[model samples]
Target: MPHKYHESQVRRTDAVEPSEEEKQTQEKPAQKEQSEEEKQMREKRRERTERGREVGAEEADAGEKT
Candidate 1:
């Protein structure tokens, strides 16, 4: 009598090749440049805040009656 198999078996050497899109995603550097741009944006925002404060103080004094 022949023996019966109870479970499915997978080969150890089988490997699925990465798709083209996956390869491109792995090679992309957009995130690194995005963070640098974000840092620059924050610096600009701080500069704007400082300028606004100076303008606001000048406006406040100009509006007061001496």
Candidate 2:
């Protein structure tokens, strides 16, 4: 005896378009603004993080020497 299998089929359909209001909301959002002081603080935090990494690496190398 031989086994029998059923075949599957798919139907094509047109895509639904978005309404005017939906299109507007889907558009790009407004840019955000940051204050000068906030920007400066952010940069300072980044510099401190990098400096900390360098110091840690130096300490590790020194420890290995002892």
Candidate 3:
């Protein structure tokens, strides 16, 4: 008896080649230097995000305790 499914019956898609422009963009772009003020602002934003997460967790725990 023949099997109900066969690998040969399955269709496969071929990989498309990237255009010249796409290939160029695929390469890593130059990184811009960040100024001191930019760096400080990024750090402050990160700290605030983390603090918010901590407060949310504490509130969840308080709800579970009560």
Candidate 4:
């Protein structure tokens, strides 16, 4: 016996619909604003670190001369 592969058998006749929860999830906005705030906070932290390093180097130089 030969196997039959038909287009009608593979195709779906009914339209697939999203459930209520799925619809709500699709509608909800992700935390893009929160992510931007976090990025800004990280940049500020890096700037502070660089400044502290420069100050530490200056202090060490002053101490060496004393």
Candidate 5:
């Protein structure tokens, strides 16, 4: 069999290398700094989420008592 293209013409993904910034981002853990407003929003959302779970738990406990 004869190949139409040469070796250099073929694209190889493995040859691609990550840059220094990319490598650093991967190596170092990301630290997200949220603003005061963002922090308050996140806290409120978290409390709202846990509130549902708490309600469910209370209902389950009440059912067990019946």
Candidate 6:
């Protein structure tokens, strides 16, 4: 018997994925607090919710009056 290495076995490389340095770089950029745009969106959502509640309240009042 003799040791035989095939072309496929000899031509193999490291797994195609992120390296440790790449992983480290990605990990360094931590998610910060809510951005200004996010804050504005949240404020707009709150305003819309408040408006919906007020509209519902007014509709109830109108129903009682009718």
Give the winner by TM-score. Answer: 4
Q: Which lDDT tens digits does candidate 5 get at residues 6-66?
A: 7766544434777688787776544333356678899987875676587886775575579
Question: Given candidate 1, what's the lDDT at residue 39?
Answer: 96
- Model 2 TM: 0.34
Poorest lDDT segment (10 consecutive residues) of candidate 1 = 6-15
The lDDT for every candidate, in the order shown, is 0.67, 0.59, 0.62, 0.69, 0.67, 0.67
lDDT of 6 by residue, 17-60 (tens): 67798886777645333366678899987876676687886775
TM-score against truth, every candidate: 0.41, 0.34, 0.34, 0.44, 0.33, 0.35
What are the per-residue Cα lDDT tens digits for candidate 2 across 3-64?
35333321122114666777766663431233566788999877766766878867755755
Candidate number achieving the greatest lDDT relative to the actual structure = 4
User: For model 6, which pairs clash?
Assistant: none
| TM-score of predicted structure 3 | 0.34
- Model 1 lDDT, residue 50, Cα: 76
Give candidates' CA RMSD values in order: 8.8, 13.6, 14.2, 8.7, 10.6, 9.5
lDDT of 3 by residue, 1-66 (tens): 988656554332212566677776666343223356678899987876676687886775575579
lDDT of 4 by residue, 1-66 (tens): 855755665454322566687876776566566678889999987876676687886775575579
Model 3 residue pairs with clashes: none
Candidate 1 accuracy as TM-score: 0.41
What residue pairs clash in candidate 2, if any at all? none
- Model 1, position 66: C-alpha lDDT score: 50
Q: Write the per-residue lDDT of candidate 1 for residues 1-66, one digit (tens) a residue.
A: 854643342232222556688777877788778889999999987876676687885664564435
Global Cα lDDT for candidate 2: 0.59
RMSD of 3: 14.2
Give the worst 10-residue stretch by lDDT in candidate 2. 6-15
